[model samples]
Target: MVKRCSWGTCNSDTRYPERIINVSFLPFPKPKTNYDACLRWIKACGRPVEQLNVNKITRDTYVCSKHFVGGFPSEKNPDPFPATGGQIYEARVKSRKRKYVELEHNSAEPSCSVPEVPCIDHVNPIILSRNENDKDTQTDEIVYTNLDLVAHNLSIKNLEEEKNALIKQNEDLKMQLASCVEQDFKLKSKRSPAKKHKQVVNNKKFSAETVANSNIKKLFEYYTGLTYVRFILLVNFLFPEEGINPVNYKEKRKEVKAMLLTDQLFLVLCRLRNGLHIKDLAYRFNIKPQSVSVIFKSVIHYMYLKLGYLSYWPHRDTIIQNMPQQYKQEFPTCLAIIDCTELKTEKPSSLKSQSQCYSDYKSSTTLKSLVVTDPRGSVIFVSDLFSGSISDNEICKESGFYKLLQQLKDQGYLQDNDGIMADKGFRIEKDLGELNLRLNIPPFASTATQMSSGDVALTRKIAAHRIHIERSINQIKNFKIVNRRIPGTLFYNINEIWTVCSLLTNFQDTLVKM
Candidate 1:
């Protein structure tokens, strides 16, 4: 038989046709001697055997055949020798060194099971190298590599941008706050300011001498047929005790009547009524043109209130009974002869007033008045004041004349057999037809027909009848107070003066004819 293998040899396999023994399982024949030899071998490898510290044999200390094939037996293993412990263990010295080196390179801790590293994509490798050198040197040497310098510059730029953004936002907020504060201040200032209290004064004083000397008293007596005292009594009866006293009563009545006789005032009104210039009236009255204007306005106000009633059209029956016999037979239901006339006024100072007062017909500043007359040249009605800017049709509608006609119709006073005569400006034919009233309008006369014999005969008759209206307007305007340009303050007074003049004309006509 072949000599059996003694120590540290493996013998057992039919494939090799020989018995093999494993050295790891071999028992130590001389323990101290073998252990010393193993220790010496370990020391010769330049690794310390004392660090292995293998003293006993155990399963945990055993190394398998796989470990031996990998050639890991070294001092780095827990047990390098198998004869002492009857086991072998593998060393991972090179692997551990490699892992430690990798961890340092990546700046990460290593684990035996797995290794983790911070994502290197976002980190600049150049910057990482600098950091490693700095760690070794323990000195903060600012290695400004292209990537490291770019990163630092970018960081600085970002910081500056953030600071600028914050500053801009701060300024915007301040501006908004300032605006709000200013608005609040304005609101506070809008409130009303404080004012001192005032005491009421009550004093009654009259001048007998001045009253006696003023021609107003004489004029008042002539118009009202009463002294100041009697006139006050009549006024008291009409108005009852309101706030008016003897002093106010005397003053107002004297002022009202005296306005009609004022030389300058009367002259201007006479000029308006007769269509005369201010210079003409000024010469006639021996007063300046400016004085004429002042007087005219005063008189207009005085007369307007006193005579405004003349503007009201009488009832149909009243008009009929008062009509002349010829007019009654031909146009028994004739209510009024309507016409438009322009009154001259001063040039307006404002553009709007100039435009308003300018009349196309007169090519001057004028106020248009609508005059209505009966057959006897007596004015029965006049319209309220209107701008010369308006058309005749517009004035008629705005004057409430249509409503007045409707009212007459509803009252059963507008007779179907009756009619109204008007110039071409009225366009009243269709309107009167709707009310079952007739309209008599004259036809336009051409130059050829105006000179014809038959035309002239018919024209004469028509003119004779139509002339009454013109005469009536002339009579109404004859009042010196209505003949001239009225003052702006006395615009309403013009209406009153027109009415009073109309009433006077009616009175005169009645006294003379009837």
Candidate 2:
């Protein structure tokens, strides 16, 4: 076993013991046998406690002889204080005293005597004497010089001059700092009035223009569910002739407040995206809650009409071109993936209405809608809201999706061999077969207790590709207006709000990028 010094900066090791002369590695005192000594040794090593755990110390752990007094520890000096310039002098003094005592003991015979020199005050002397039967001792004294005192006084004078110079320099720096501070105060005072006026104007009003430019992207996305650029694009799209259309639009609705169209759009988007209450919006926009309600309804209606075409069904060529590779390989002819999503709503006061809206699937009152997306994750069609109690088959038939497909097929936008992928709950296989359209869904193990390997693989493949539709639905629900429980106050506009939110998600970046 090789011994290694545990001191942080030590390179002493038994492997190369010859490199360092007169150095010996000492084992750490066993904590069980000498706990206090072991702790002292560890502390003297100058290593962090975490790096040197006492319990983990093995026989190989060591501290080099250089760390102890007298080059190594001994009974005479058991402590392991590190050997330093100051400690070496103390050790030498103790050794000299011990040697003198030994010499006295060795000359114990009656004739063997050693003379001691007497110490005199105010004199430096060198005296050497040999004992001779108590003869008088002779001493040589050296006189002190005035030169030493003059040099000491000169050093003191020089230090005082240096200190005075540093004090003067510090005072100069302070004066310069004060002048700089005064100039800064004057500059700030000159700009304060203009800055104060601007702040007051900004604080007294809340509008789209008030948000800092650097934070527009994040803040607009938060409040509008769209970036600043996208929000501007949306604004331009909806109110094309902004100056003429918006004012006329507001006047036609008999809205009293002369608010900007951008502010109106911002208010509506905030209400929908953040789910903020009417009174909260009123306070924010500094308008009556009644005006807020009217603006929200009018803007939502205008948006619903303008953005309705966003979810129109695409041509077969376009769908095929944008389909992902995973779908291209397994579901090459797949046209659209369909899934149903439900939004929880407040309970109705009427027992009959409650019974109609209560869904066993969610164990709550919900309004369900069917969402359809192409293989590349663009929403193609979104069905009208249905009672939550309705089944997938009932909603599909009632949603006019099959009729729309037939119509698209008649217009050559769809073909006979194209497929529609859906969850197993849809149960629209026979219905699709009548229209010469293929139904791609997972297989059910109804025929036997378990499905065969081929059926299981088919189900796995279909389910894997079907997940994109779920992602599309998730993005639509990202709009908070349709995500949370719908308030009774907005129950009348829930359908339009839900439809508008579904269409708005298409304006976002494509879910499955090509």
Candidate 3:
């Protein structure tokens, strides 16, 4: 039997060593051991899976070294395949070398074009030619310029300048005339008895003025995710100086066509709460799309800082005081419920980023964040967003939540017997032990065919309390920006936006009843 290269269109065979020199045949990987690598190799062979069988691979099945980088596969490139058929390593290198050799061989000789006779009517022009070698003799010719042609060219340039000047002057006069007409019209309108033209309001335009004029609380809530009174409070908190008179406030920097800072804030909130497109927001705000984007980023950054207090971890006494009746009766020591939530996002163009952001559970690209809520369903702490591929146990450990709990324990805010509630997905009992705190996760049926009766009851009770964290997560996702698939345009500030949404959920109505 002949050992032939299995690569696409490759003719390398052991029987014809003279036809293809310095090439060796490699056997296919065994499916039982390196199954994934073997599949990849078979796919790289460019043969249909139905036509090939890895189980029947014999010594005659192989791939040639010409398909690999560096003319061979090494430890660094054990699973080798050509990126493209035309980009085969050996072939590309040989083609490059052959072209270089042809250039070098051709350059060894010097060649020049024969000179042509100049027409009698026109001035002669100089010709330049250079050769690589020093063997060619060169000649120089005298050239003369046409005076009349040069003068005519200069006159035409002067005429163009004069024409440009006249155009500018005409535009200036037109502007002056229009200004005079506007002044005359204003004077006449003031003197005339004609009823003043009613100022037309654009209902489509969204701003503080529009919301105030509409006086619709639902519209306010729909746009900002906050009622009228709460929205006012939020504005005051974010911009204390301009809180009372944000509509009339003037910015030090020139505003976007005299737009108020409050309007910008309203625009940002509408974008976050409604997931409004940048162009739509621009149209509503009477500004350019770029301006809307800039305002949204700048204001959201400010809001991210202003809203940072919402993520504060409540003191132990505060947590106990706010603990719901259900938690107090069954699990008095329960402090906070924790859970990881994911939001779908656009698939990233990069393969590495796609892998990092993909969630097998969601089966889509997403961003994940850890949400921590007290028993009363108030979001106390929200961690920065992590890649969706991260595991719940890993997120809990790496998100600084455990470390912070340990710090609180050292400070006497968190005690040894106090418990952190979470689902069985969090395998952090050992981690909590290091912090001198207890994990209140429901019992897992690990190593058991079935859970005992007591384990079943405990699981139900824990799940009843754990449901608040889920509700809190739902509240955070109520903001449409984090609820739907986040666009790639917002990926740069996605962490900040996700944090803001999580924190803002603290301002919403409580999820857990007393």
Candidate 4:
């Protein structure tokens, strides 16, 4: 096979040992010039040649030793040069060569445009500008002036004072320049997004084929935490009608860089399911971190809108019919179980927001929500999230849970005697005293340290039945976004994320039997 040097400016045959170096051994520094970078890039990737075994070669296939003095740079001498001591390898020569060529071309012009003067040949001819003088007379006059100055008395102190004044002026100029530089830096920082955008455009990207062409079970679910079938179910449920705007602008738009809808959806899910950071998604999706944010925001909004299918309060009859025999037998009047959970959130910069979101219990900022589910573990209600600072009673009332309960009661879905089981967190004795409702909670003591056997038995029974909602919450958090700290960018929609995830729990093959 005929071989040619891949390095720019090296086109010699590679058959000669003196001309070629083994690329596998030497690690060359990154090319500085565009021409060299292009060649280096293609050469590293290899070209469409060896496959056919025709012995033909691509332009970027080899680097001849001619491009390096001692051959290609390696551990021994990383800064090797060309074989010739004078012409160093990779050193810029175009400007110098151009200058020499221009000088030769301009040689035809008179070396000195001015006519010669008497005894002018003894002086330099190049500086004879406009006048016939060789400019030596000006130097002679300076020498005569210095000699006359020496003949007179010149004060050294005056020279030193003048020098000091000039130095002070220079120092002031430098201070002003430094201040300007500092201000410029602040301005640039304030406008860093554009600079970051340029960096994002260069990140490596891949086609949808990366996921589309792979099996769902092998690694897809590992990364996304959802099986392909379930993911496809979500896509089909919301797509075509509720999907985001298509990335494609025109027919068969080749060279398009925007992610495909499936890929985009998958990328968004991974962020939520795995709690992946924007940068992590950027590298996986082969896009910029900012683009990841853009895709995530657009996709998550649509998914939140599509949450209707995932969770809903089942009608009273539906709940009764699906109610497992164990729940019905144990707690016949038990209507629903309610619990509160806190999801950690990224700290907001606003003092008010941070104070409002800070959770003393969790020692962090969080979003607190109340989840009410039927005995069968199907989520009936996931309240609008309460800021962590809000008390449980306030959340129960402000989230419209009381209103929802009123509707159920008025609609006869919940009877006046049907009870709502809760954890100790609820203090309905004070909040809903006038409603005459049955609120079953674990026994607490302000007086004695011990509980009566009857009270203990009641607590255990109620807990056994209420455990389903706890299970429901656990299942909901399986969708990671809520389980992990909610990213700050999505703090505004923490409620939506919670609702959607909770709703998705209902789709899981009846994890709640009743």
Candidate 5:
């Protein structure tokens, strides 16, 4: 039996035996008389007991004011157990440290009236102090247990799942990006074809009338003889040894007359005389531009080398033999009037090139050529083309015109009886004396004789006679080919054309004046 201590003012309790000492309690009846018997009862009941010593018990009454010994009254002396009634109660105060309490039965409920003892149940198992009041508690239930391990395992699993989900999402995003890139590439590749199709749909075609109006057709007529095939064939017959041949006529072939007529050649001559562009000729003939260019070059080359012979100056002996009787005594050995002229052209592209071809007269690029004509207005000599950058004096010097004069002198053509009439630019009066030739040029009026007199009158007469060559030059220029800008490809061909036209002019003069 357990009892509360009588030290209420002292604050001591018997059930909590460590809290008080020096308090007397009456001895209770022993359950078994001997220690062996007590041990047997303890084993049978399977109950816990507090430690006791036989030496601590007194003979008349073993008193422990702190606690009772058993749950029974003594059979040998049965008076109610009395507490020691001494004011000398020794009180013990409990420490502030936590104490544990055990319930007597599994179903026992806590009471509000009793002072509470705080208890902790750790999830992880731990050893607990035994309670004398608790007899049937299981030992397995007393251990503290850890609660965090299961929570930790679950968190690790969740983290692994989240990682897998993120990896799958990243792969899906990469696939989507790749698809977008592929689509962009395909779109770019398709653009060029679409643009090309649009261009085709928007393109315009040229019309028949517009083609007819193009200069290409005129080019054909100017180049193809228009009808000069017959004259070409005829001249070819006369100069068979000089690389001229009929288009198809051969020996043992009956002299088949040409299917084409001479009127065509005359028409071509008229066109050449007019100097129309090859493209314009092509337009008139309804032919291709290239065809006109080729035909014109071939026919012009043929006529220049073959039928164009009459334009050249007569040989020295021929001139001597054919000199007119009236002038034979005065100027018996005169050859021709020589002059230079400028033909304008389009400006060249480069600045240096522009300088090379520039002429102050037209203030643009030009071709320069020299012409020598007899008193009759027939061209006897012509020089190769030169840039307009050259002056008349430079041209005369570089063209070897003086050399030709020397040659004529050596041949007895420039005897004391002969004289040449030239413009003021010739300045050859003193130079002619060295070559045994005489120069006749118009003289400038002096300050004293500002009004013209005898010498001026004679100079005018000579100039009037020399003016025929200028007229011939004008006639030659009537052909637009010579008057207009010549293409660079046709440069060599233009020289030939010049010779041919000069010869034609002489021929026509002779025919018409005869």
Candidate 6:
């Protein structure tokens, strides 16, 4: 194989495994600059690089003359400066070191405190030595021009670098001094101010507004049994005057603080629909139980006012128009189906309340309501809760539905011929007949007789139609609070719970087609 010598100075085109006659081969060593210039010369002596076993050569690396026998280098022929092993070269370099040392010692005057001197015999360069020597300008000039010119240039270069570095450092120190002076001046000019502050965070750890954004969407239906859209609609319907109006509006009412209109509505619905304790709601809405109670009371009263109009028993004509085919065919002028629903609750500790609330029928302390739905299964009316101990006929009358019917009939909205369909549980036929209104009740078994086939068919038919009120009541009781044993905390305003739940059912998707 052909190989070109790596040295520009020794550009040989000889085949491998053959020696270059005059060049020396040295492996690149641990750093020493004295070996550098020697590697740059062409030579016709010594073993080839392959024999020296330098398998690879990088741009910065070298192998050259001073490592081999005939390639011994001297000061006069210092193109490839002598390697460290040469005794003659070492002596010459040592002599140059002493000369520079003497020059530095003699020149250590006031002007040259930061000394600038020739570098020679780099193994131990002549630094600022204290020993002085005779000053001879001619000798110094001869030594500098001939032997130490490179060393002289090197000294000048180092001195220039030091001088530039010192100048930069001085500029940095001046800048820092100016900045420090400015800071001191500003500090002295500024005056101290009075100490005062206002409360920023609310007293409650979580403000109502915070809870509404984070948990309301995720738990909207679970807590309220209403979607976000339905909840907002309910809020807008009930509390329109409480908020800023969009058109021809004035903000007279103090804007609700912290809690949003939606949050207030959602808060009440969660409690009523879930039958959750005020404290449980407090945790969910991130507020105290007292706040939950206050919000609950306010929302219930608000819903009563807003939703009471839905309980308006429709005129006989309106009912007839909206009645389903089954009712129209079987009992064409049937106004509505009526039933009583029971809500189990805590036994009141007070004798009076317990006596009033206890039901022999359910054998449990319970709340009851008169739930009414049109033939198409839409809730047209829900009475305020009554004691479960109250008889169905009494609840029917005392619920003021009888009075409402009487008023509507007197006002000519209800007709004498129009009637209500109910299960045999309601014995209001005679009472309603006194008002010249009919009550279509399914027949019950007498003591000694069996119901005829036709009578049984009629009862079954009426019972089938009665399922509408059953479904309507079921919907209201779907709120766990109404379905489960009541907590005493809500026993006081249990009427409001029944009223709100009953009214909310009407706002849901139409239960019966018109």
Q: Write the per-residue lDDT of candidate 1 for residues 1-514, one digit (tens) a residue.
A: 2222221332423234433334232221233556654443332222223333335322232222322333334455433344333323333233221111111324242222222333546543332333554555424322322333343344456456667888998999999999999998877666323211111110001122223245664643333223445534434443355643212221233323332232222343344445556676555544456655555565445445545533356667777787777667666666767888777777867999889988898888888877777666666667776778878878777777777777878887676656778776678677677778776665567876455676566455556667778877776656545667666655646566555555546444332143
lDDT of 6 at 90: 27
Prediction-by-prediction clash tally: 23, 0, 0, 9, 41, 8
Q: What is the TM-score of each candidate against the true structure?
A: 0.42, 0.59, 0.59, 0.54, 0.46, 0.55
Alpha carbon lDDT at 194, candidate 4: 76
Candidate 5 deviates by what RMSD? Answer: 33.2
Q: Candidate 2: where are CA atoms >4 Å away?
A: 1-205, 212-217, 246-257, 309-311, 447-449
- Identify the runs in model 4 with alpha carbons over 4 angstroms from their true place: 1-218, 240-258, 308-311, 410-412, 429-437, 445-449
Q: Write the per-residue lDDT of candidate 5 for residues 351-393, one digit (tens) a residue.
A: 8877988989778788887787766666767776688898776
After superposition, the stretches of candidate 3 with alpha carbons farther than 4 Å from their true spots are 1-200, 203-205, 212-217, 243-253, 309-311, 446-449
Q: In candidate 4, residue 155 scores what lDDT?
A: 27
State the RMSD for candidate 1.
32.5
- Give one digit per residue, the lDDT tens place, for model 3 in 276-355: 99999877766678777777777778778778854378788988887887789898888888999998989999999999
**Residue 141 in model 4: shift from native, Å?**
32
Q: What is the model-wide C-alpha lDDT for candidate 3?
A: 0.74
RMSD of each predicted structure: 32.5, 20.8, 28.0, 22.9, 33.2, 17.1
- Model 6 TM-score (2 dp): 0.55
What's the lDDT for candidate 5? 0.55
Candidate 3, residue 33: how far the Cα is off, in Å: 96
